[model samples]
Target: MSDSDLIKLYSKQILALATEIPHLGTLEDAEGEAKARSPLCGSTVTVGLALADGKVSRFAQNVKACALGQASAAVLGKVVIGLDRTTLQQGRDALHAMLTKNGPVPSAPFDGYEVLLPARDFKNRHASILLPFDATLNAIDAS
Candidate 1:
């Protein structure tokens, strides 16, 4: 990647988001918990959650990843409190398509993911970027 590409991928907004990750710890009584790692970058995220009325009732995460991954987690952290499994799955699918197939940004609540659009060209970073969503979804399943 060129300097210009790096600049685009790590814009001030992305960097700001990266530093503001929320729910940054584990939950002792969580109903589900899961972790995802990006082999290409060795980035990882762990998610712990509890569900009520078939929706996420509580959530937390430990994000140890690149700026791209952190930004993704920041977005998810800000919006995941009330989502259900289907919504999280769709967000993951949409984010995947956006990165790999030039698809649209994920829908609202998750739309904050648009900050990661520039990452579409960085295949190796895709896994890390998707870590939060993957871990959360897996955590839901593990519940």
Candidate 2:
């Protein structure tokens, strides 16, 4: 890929999202917790959750990833509270499709994922882009 294409992977929107990271610390009393690592880039994300009524009551993550991964976590942080398993799964699936299959933007509450579309062209960055969702899924499943 050209330098410009690689540069595009860290678009302004992506960087802005990355800077807006939420739930920045781990929850001390989390009911579920999980971690995911991208061996290709040494990016890591650990998600912690507190669930109630089968929905997320609180969420937190420790993200050590590139701009794309941070952006993905930022998007999730915005809507994770009150979300159910099905919705979280849909977000993960939609994000996967967006990156790997050129699919439509992730549905409502997750439309923030659209900011990551430019990352699709940079194949090597795909794993980092996916770390948030994978770690989240593991966290939720553990709950």
Task: Note the Cα lDDT for every prediction shown.
Answer: 0.94, 0.89
Error of 1 at 12 (Å): 0.4
Candidate 1 similarity to native, TM-score: 0.97
**Candidate 2 lDDT by residue in tens digits, 49-116:** 98899899999999999998899889988898998888889888888898889999998999988888
Per-structure clash totals for the candidates: 0, 0
**Candidate 1 lDDT score relative to the true structure:** 0.94
Q: Model 2 clash pairs? A: none
- Strongest candidate by lDDT: 1
Pairs in steric clash, model 1:
none
Error of 1 at 52 (Å): 0.6
Full-model lDDT, candidate 2 = 0.89
Q: Which regions of candidate 1 deviate over 4 angstroms? A: none
